[model samples]
Target chain A: DVKVTQSSRYLVKRTGEKVFLECVQDMDHENMFWYRQDPGLGLRLIYFSYDVKMKEKGDIPEGYSVSREKKERFSLILESASTNQTSMYLCASGVGQGIVLTKNIQYFGAGTRLSVL
Target chain B: AQRVTQPEKLLSVFKGAPVELKCNYSYSGSPELFWYVQYSRQRLQLLLRHISRESIKGFTADLNKGETSFHLKKPFAQEEDSAMYYCALKDRGGKLIFGQGTELSVKP
Candidate 1:
């Protein structure tokens, strides 16, 4: 089975604080992704990394940055946390990405629910 | 731009009844469609994919290229099937765009 693990299940952070959400995958996937899940918004991609030290912006990358210093790890950073940033954050990884938008399959972590006050 | 759309935010049904969760997408190139399910306190997992063309847990989805849709259907809903379902579109970049999601509620 593919195992994607997150650092936290629930977190509380004050506004303007720097926040880090960590994720690790045991599947040796080449692609890692970060997403925020809102009630009606579903899962919106924030950032993704195809290889170590490589990153790309997703549909919603504002107020967020990502790091992939190691093969098994991908981290999502909030430079300055805000109330609007409070949500359930998800982490995912996959092997070689699809040739087009429809070919890839991303396996996900358990999720980290962060609350920014 | 490539996009995935789930018209329903919530779907409720009694156990043993038929159920369908709709998903539609817009993409120029060949797309791979998938259904991911997240049960309470569980990580999101792949339920089914169009390319695989298999039914899981009694649920099946047919990808209609002409209609640009892949709607998941089950002959009978189960209580354990109640969860959040997301439809995703993987773009040429190999990244995924997810739909708004549909929450399935099955009551006895």
Candidate 2:
């Protein structure tokens, strides 16, 4: 079984504060992703990392950055958290060679619900 | 650009009734489609994929290229089957573009 762990289940931050959401996977997957879930909007990708130090922007990457200094860990950074940023964040990891997207099977963490006040 | 569309945001059915959740996509090339489910307090997991052509948890979906739809169906709606279902499309780069998702509620 694959295990994807998010560092927090519930988080709270003030406006204009910096926030970090951490994720770790035990499956040694090569691809990691961060997504935000909102009502009626589904899961929107924030950022993704294919390899260490390699990152790509997803559909909703504004005001957010990601770090992948190691294979097992991926971190999402909110530069200046705002009330609008309050939402459920999810992290997923997939085992793929990074060449073909269809071959990748992603496993997701439990998710972190963040509240920005 | 690849896109996924799940028209229904919510669906309700009585137990032992048939249920269907509609999903459509707009992709220029051949696309890979997937269905994912998230139970209460559980992480999102893959329910099934078009390539595999398998039924999972009594739920099955068929890809219709003509209509560009992949609708999930089940003969009987079980209370345990109630969950948030998402339809996703795999882009050329392996990134998944997801639909807005549909919440299924099976009334006993």
Docking quality tier of model 1:
medium
- Give the per-residue Cα lDDT of candidate 2 at A27: 86
Q: Evaluate residue A85 in candidate 1 and report its C-alpha lDDT on the 0 to 100 scale.
A: 97
Q: For candidate 2, lDDT tens digit of each residue in A15-103?
A: 99999999999988889999999989999999998889889999999999999999999999999999999999999999767634436
TM-score of each: 0.96, 0.98
Give each model's clash number: 7, 1
> TM-score (0 to 1) of chain B, per candidate?
0.97, 0.97
Point to the candidate with the largest TM-score. 2
Candidate 2 chain B minimal-lDDT segment of 10 residues = B89-98
Best by lDDT: 2
Where does candidate 1 stray beyond 4 Å? A97-103
